[model samples]
Target chain A: MNSSSISNYINTLFPQFEPALREKLIEQVTIKDFKAGEHLMQTGQYFRSTVLIVEGRVKLYREGTDGNEFFMYYLQPGEACALSMICAAKQESSKIMGKAIEDSTILMVPITLMDDLMKQYPSWYYFVMETYRSRFEELLLVIDSIAFNGLDQRLSFYLQKQQEQLQTNELQLTHQEIASDLNSSREVISRLLKKMEQKGEIKLYRNFIELKK
Target chain B: MNSSSISNYINTLFPQFEPALREKLIEQVTIKDFKAGEHLMQTGQYFRSTVLIVEGRVKLYREGTDGNEFFMYYLQPGEACALSMICAAKQESSKIMGKAIEDSTILMVPITLMDDLMKQYPSWYYFVMETYRSRFEELLLVIDSIAFNGLDQRLSFYLQKQQEQLQTNELQLTHQEIASDLNSSREVISRLLKKMEQKGEIKLYRNFIELKK
Candidate 1:
């Protein structure tokens, strides 16, 4: 996208950004693309920049010593992944692997620029405050689901949420991905999906599932 | 604590506050105390100010339908809360409740004071940024634990963390409190605690668990 388009998008999301500051930010940002399955970052790497997704998707996951995996969530266009990690784990240790779910483009803002902008702009502080607040709220939801909600309810809620957010009855998901998200096994997720299909709640396709009305 | 003491604490935590800005903040803050189990703020209450804990502790949690409770950690002295909820959730829709854990005193800085401070002392932006970053980080750890760890592991981890952070081998926690935190039944938690005690990993008192190293 052109600088003008980026500026407009940024302005729409944060109306506090002044025209001059927007211009400076647009100048500082470098948009880069990645194909599916490309790992953009991994555990132990220093996080030196904040990323705003311009297109496509990324998933953050951590692997355990027992060879098990837990999927945090997916980052969509316009969302951020690094900000939360950096804030929580510090710049050097906030390492969850960021892998491409598709051909993705991201607007990268270097930490140096961010530090400068935070100093120079009051609006930037407000923006950061809001972003962190939303991240906090999202994490609370995830925690609630894991603590009280069972796997069946969690999976159902996930599918319902996905159907609503993606605006589609069909989902581009695999059993293993769903398993990783719910902290269960692929076989368990497959069995659950089959059960749901038999109950007419959804239909299992080759690589996807379609929710039934 | 007097204004100088409060300012000194603020300065120690936030470098940007320095001496002069810290003095300014001390002028704007007022200290007040709450008795144990007193509601500092309820779910539907609008957050008109942010608080800096000067002494004692505060519990942050949410009560769901059917009277089920979920504990979202406590705010220790020198910590702050509610900036994210104030910015993100609609005034009446946020699902959180804050209460004084004991007879506690806090320095309250009204939102208007903060607004003025941000304008007059842009350097103090770092103070808000630091608090916001820590809140965001804590939320991520909660999310990570929920997504990857089981109920037993979560309880173990929570006890271990509290032991470390509080710098005490004996944790003043009730079975009901532990159940609320784990989002499980009190009976279950009581049984588990008894089992852990029998296994010689811990010692249980009337309202506490002493981790035996």
Candidate 2:
């Protein structure tokens, strides 16, 4: 909202960044907000700046030709967008989509100052590297799931991830939504979920899933 | 190899690097050779250095619990191993496997110098970023294929990629290998190839396939 609040956001959420780097971010960043269910990023869009989430949640996914979305991962208040950095550094168009699942806010750092920041601040430099490293690992995990695991195992993993990210056992998602996120048919997802329920792994409701602890 | 040969390798393969950085690489990088099929990287192994392919081809893949190798992509001359950099930066263990598909040589740059190089050489910094970007995009494409496409389409993409990378219409591969790479059954791959052949797209022999123009 204001300079002081922006400073508070940086200092509180990204205290690992050096004081001067945080000051630079406070000075240069343009804060943008997105309402729930709004697109934060879209495929074929060129990124002008890298984004750091300051509030709420964002889900990143790959879109299919048929408009199906294969869910990737989420960005929380303290995380930076990996695709944003990758596309921004190369000035290339995004191959994926990001949506704000909740009312969200992000601070955008211009690409022009990337080299300067990497050189000027050691903390900022490692922060960028660490961001790439974490996101890279996340992508690798996603690949492992899709490549090695069966659909039932993948659904289990999907539920586990949702539980971990939302920090709740009750996942507010429909069967159709799960089917869409996994790029599977609703009938198939329903069959697998019913099997999970039979196995005592979960309880399914109309629009939510309760995972057994 | 001799220092002069190493200098030649750097000068010839990576002329984009500044002279000073090239000199530094020649001084610090260890030249290691791998016989065909030798492991360059293993799942759960720690990485001490970032690898750059100087000669021959390396196949990077995800290994499943049953030791199934889902082909990721190939790393050729002038390319750095993105997983190597990601794991080295965090001193984390690798999650994937890399093998020399052909007899190969690589320049191993110690992880300790990564920070110094990033801060000192703009070219080196951008090179590292580009390596990660390319690998990330490759992984995304793999995800897209698996999540969105059916087996037949996936097989076609697999063959197309193989043709492009091997730079030959005649692919020196077996049905078993194709099935293994795509994480499908040998019979299924054979059936798909037969269909492609019936369509006059290719001619399959004992160990290789010849793509028709």
RMSD of each: 3.5, 1.0
Clashing pairs in model 1, backbone N/Cα/C closer than 3 A = A88-B137
lDDT of 2 by residue, B1-213 (tens): 568878888999999999999999999998889999999999999999999999999999898888889998999999999989988988999988999999999999999999999999989998999998999999899999999998999998999998999999999999999999898899999999999999999999999999988
Q: Quote fnat for model 1.
A: 0.46
Name the 10 consecutive residues with the lowest summed lDDT in model 1 chain A.
Answer: A82-91
Query: What is each candidate's DockQ, to 2 decimals?
Result: 0.43, 0.86
CA lDDT of every candidate = 0.71, 0.92
TM-score, model 1 to reference: 0.86
Candidate 1 lDDT over residue span A48-137, tens digit each: 677777677787665554555556667787676645334332454554567888898777777777666755776665665556666666
The estimated TM-scores of all candidates read: 0.86, 0.98
Best by TM-score: 2
Residue B161 CA displacement from its true place in model 1, Å: 2.4
